[model samples]
Target: MRHTDVVIIGGGPAGLAAAVKLWEQGIRDILILEREHHLGGILRQCIHDGFGLTRFGETLSGPEYAQRFIDQVEKYKIPYITDVTVIGLDKEKKVTAAHKEGILEIQAKAVVLAMGCRERTRGAISIPGERPAGVYTAGVAQAYMNLQNIMVGKEVIILGSGDIGMIMARRMTLEGAHVKGVFEVQPYASGLPRNVEQCLNDYGIPLKLSHTVTDIKGRDRLESVVISQVDEKMQPVPGTEKEYPCDTLILSVGLIPENELSLMAGVKLDERTKGPEVNEKHETTVPGIFAAGNVLQVHDLVDFVSMEAEELADSVAEYIKKDEKAEAEHTQGEEAEEYMADVVTDGNVSHTVPQKISGKKDIRLCMRVRRPMKNCAIQLIQGGKVIQEKKMKKAIPAEMIQIPVKAGILKEKENLEVKVIW
Candidate 1:
């Protein structure tokens, strides 16, 4: 078995950033394993502009944004093998990967999980449709069109208003296809505001919220879709069904984090986030195993993914630097009577990350609301008392919410819950 200082799974933005940071931290024995032949991950298929505004201060396509990090790996001469799929991870931080070279076992001091996420396809979301040729997820269509230079269909009907669906609507429109409209089961648009405005509104594409496609017509190729409006319970309202003709149906329903390896490593997962539960340092329950980026939780922007990687790099470095101290803390963490402030959600709040927290350093808890609200305050409660609150002009589920708190305040409470109060 070969040994490395670190083994970062998945060579996407998160893994790339982690390698760069680890290199800067003087940790040279790092290896990144990517399943794909290329290292850019999903960014390579996304050819749209408007990325990197928050990070690079410039509008760039997905490939251009990823190229920046790829260039860094090449510049630093970091070691990474492509077309290597990591099969398993153990609690001891051992990694099993399979590549052209054959299966190999590597013992790593630390393992960073950046396997990213997978799209929810038609089967996962229960999209009732015939097995048709023109059906595709937004990402698959993107790869086919942008990467393979192929046309999916002449007419398209997009389901779900997520960023990808909206973007595909604009993309298909630009490619000389007629886009019928975008349908959403929820009352509010699931995509970002800018995406809705730029992709759909600017393109004169209709966005049908509180509506869902019930029946997908056609057997060989998509011919039409039966859509209907929904009530408060999200059930299709009777007699509200209407048929729309389309040659293609693209689904952008949702995404689930890739966690098979994490499960094998015996890492604890947060049910709400559908990802691994990480602490302030982004370390998972299993020591020396940390997760970041979309693997931990899906971020709305790729810039945040890079930011998460940078943060994870620092955490991994800390883990190696204070190896003994970290072990002691881990032991104490098991032996001691830890008073964890459980961040609960209520009112319009849907879910919160880092659900359980021990009063340590400052922590940032990310959350999403159940719906849209105006003039609300995020109330932090402990022992049935309001401890802290932050006001916001508006909060929407489409956008993620970041709440910061100091250890000093959290130490006073045994349990805490966050709620939206208007």
Candidate 2:
């Protein structure tokens, strides 16, 4: 058995970022486990140039962005074990992993789960289709084209207007394939607005909203797919079917966090995000075990993943150095006196983050309205008193709304309430 101060599972952007931060904080006894032969996770196959704008202040391809982090890890001499799969974890931070040589166990003071997410496939969507060779998830198609040097097909119909599907639509077009169109069940496209504009609209790709593939037809490979418009409930509308003859079909419906390890460890999960339920420190229900990146919540950009990882590292450092009993006492005292906040959603409000408030500290409340609104007023109320309010030119569910609370406000309030009106 081996022991480490910090054990980071998964060597993607999140794990690597966490390791780098740990090194900066003078924590040398850290280990990173990667199942793949190399690092970078899904970014290796993401060869597009839209990444790194937020982190590096320049547009870079996925490989380029990954290389930057890989270089940093090497520079810091962060130890990593590749081609090793972590099979089990316990609440005590004991990790059981395996490699070709043999199995190994580690007793870690802190463990960070950054295993990322998996793409939703045809089976997940239950699309009535033949088990044909041409059907592939958008990520699989990307790997084939970008890594294996294999063009998936000459013609394609993409299901799901997510970012991956939109990017692949442009990629297939550039690679001399005719992308028939993209079909999305929801009325609004689920991808980032910039991707929709730059990847699809700039390339003349048609986006079919409130639409889905009802059936697929083919023999050994895909021949065609039958699509139709969907009603408000997403049921297929009769008499609105159309057939598109294509050799390939790519499904990018959604992503599920790879949480088998978390489940095995008895960590609580959030139903809405389908990830672990974490506090402000990114620590799961089990103390000393943390999660970040896509494994916590599927983020739209790599920069966000990096930010989450850095935050987790900071938390881990503090957790390892602080006295457990003292910290628990402090936390209990803080929770006892902390004011609570209720974020009430009105028209077009979906959900809010920082679900609970730790009244001891000033909080930044973030939320999203359900629909787009013009000339909207966002109000922060406390016990029927208008505490803080702001007017905005526009509010959209796609963007996040943030409100900061100062210590002065908490001193005067017992509870926080947020609402939006137009």
Which candidate achieves the best TM-score against the true structure? 1
What is the C-alpha local distance difference test score of each model?
0.88, 0.84
Error of 2 at 226 (Å): 0.5
Q: Considering summed lDDT, which 10 consecutive residues are worst modelled in model 1? A: 331-340
Q: Per-residue lDDT for 8-30 in model 2, tens only? A: 99999899889999889878889
Clash counts for all predictions: 1, 3
Q: lDDT, candidate 1, residue 89?
A: 88
Pairs of colliding residues, candidate 1: 344-417
Instruction: List candidate 2 segments past 4 Å from native.
Output: 323-349, 362-374, 377-418
Using Cα atoms with residue i matched to residue i, what is each candidate's TM-score against the true structure? Answer: 0.94, 0.89
